[model samples]
Structures are given as structure tokens and as C-alpha cells.
Target: MSMQQFAGGNERFIRRYEYDDSWVIAADVGLDEDDIDVDIVGSTAIIVADTGERVTETEFELPSAGDASIDIHNGVLTITIQK
Candidate 1:
């Protein structure tokens, strides 16, 4: 698996990874489950976080269609797309 971190809006960085049967995406936006919102449509995943008074959003495209899951642990927001 390979991961790449790209500079995102509002000075945040989003990380993406590709696996054989899944795609993993993560970010360190310092938000919790109550503060974060995740939306998956078709092959696209959208992650948004409400950091106090500021909002940050990130978008990712998957290689194929799959079930999507989100987890926020230890300050990292992880999204997994499984086929």
C-alpha cells in the first residue's frame, strides 16, 4: 500500500492510500465524530469537519465502487472504502 499526503484547504493535509480491495483515506484535522461529517456517493468520498468556528472539507475519489466507513481515532480521521 502507498500513501500520499496533499495540502488541503485551510492549511490542512489529507492522506490517501490504495490497496488491492480497498481505498484508505485519512486526515489530521483535530476533530471528533460529532464534529466531522462524511458523505460517500458513487466513487467519491467527501469529508467535512467543523473546527470550532471554521469548517474544513476534503474530497477523495476511489478506484471502484464499494462500501464506505469512517472512523476518528487519536486525532486522525480515517475513511475506508471496501469492495
Candidate 2:
């Protein structure tokens, strides 16, 4: 699961995209206050702090074939999937 926060028009839930080198998961994610961002880039997930920058991005790993799920709670974000 990955969490991100941006100072915008009263919008707490952030957006996340699961992608690979050649395809995108075509999904939007909502973030909460206690969510963590995981860098699942090619099978690597980590927790990162909220860097109040213009744009924040990381890579995501994809399974052989499955669906991706994004969870939104209290302005935090969490992503999960199975291989």
C-alpha cells in the first residue's frame, strides 16, 4: 500500500497508479491520514514520508495476472494485490 498527500482544494484522499514499464493499472486511489506509501516497483514496497512537493511518484510491481485494489480511509491510501 502507498500513501501520498498534496495541498490542494480541501482534498485529503490522494491518487495512486499501479503501473509497469509497458502498462498502467487504470485505477485511482484515495489516501487517508495514516496511510503509508509503498514503493512496490518491480516487487519492492517501502514506507515513505509525505514530501510536500509538486509531484511525487514511485514504481509499482505487477503480478502475472490479477486485479489491483486501492483503499481510501480518513484521507490515507492503501493498495493491495495478490500474485
Candidate 3:
């Protein structure tokens, strides 16, 4: 597992996981907003405000290939396996 802290008051956590193939899971996002948005670009993903106020991008290295889901709480974001 790896972690990175943003200068703009946001943090990210990533873990190497393999389900069907191989996947990288990214989570632990701290956003000061009501809603959150996500953008997936290959192995990289971006998180931002739904109102286009601010944006934070995080990169994850996948193990093989898998899917993920973003969990939200009090403007905090956490990524988990998509079921």
C-alpha cells in the first residue's frame, strides 16, 4: 500500500489488489465540498468537486485489472471494490 498527501488539504491511499486479473485501489480522499466527482484515465484517476470548484488527481498502479467504487462521508472519499 502507498499513500500521498496533497497540498490542497486532500490525501490519497492506494493498494495493490487482484480480483479477476489485477487492479490498483485508490481511496482516502479529503474534499471540502458537498459532492465529489471522479475521472478514470487508464491506471490514473482524478477526483474533483461536482460543481467544478476544485480538482484533485491521483494515480494508481493496478495489479491486473478490476473495478472500484468511491465511498463518500462528510466530504471524505474512500475507494472500495465495486460490487
- Top-lDDT candidate index: 1
Q: What value does the lDDT take at residue 49 in candidate 3?
A: 58
For candidate 3, the lDDT comes to: 0.49
For 1-83, candidate 3 gives per-residue lDDT tens digits of 34444333333443444345323353445454466676555545566554466554445443322376556766455555432
Which portions of model 1 show Cα errors greater than 4 Å? 55-58
Q: Local distance difference test, per candidate?
A: 0.79, 0.43, 0.49
Comparison by lDDT, 2 against 3, better one: 3
Instruction: Report the candidate with higher TM-score, 2 versus 3.
Output: 3
Relative to the unseen true structure, what is the C-alpha lDDT of residue 22 in candidate 3, on a scale of 0 to 100?
Answer: 29
TM-score of each: 0.74, 0.29, 0.42
The positional error of residue 51 in candidate 1, measured at the CA in angstroms, is 3.6
- Regions of model 3 farther than 4 Å from truth: 1-34, 50-64, 81-83
- Overall local distance difference test of candidate 1: 0.79
Each prediction's number of clashing residue pairs:
0, 10, 4
Residue-wise C-alpha lDDT for candidate 2, range 1-83, written one tens digit per residue: 43333444444333433444222222233434444465454444343535454335544444433443545465455555553
CA deviation > 4 Å runs, candidate 2: 1-53, 62-65
TM-score of 1: 0.74
Ranking by lDDT: 1, 3, 2
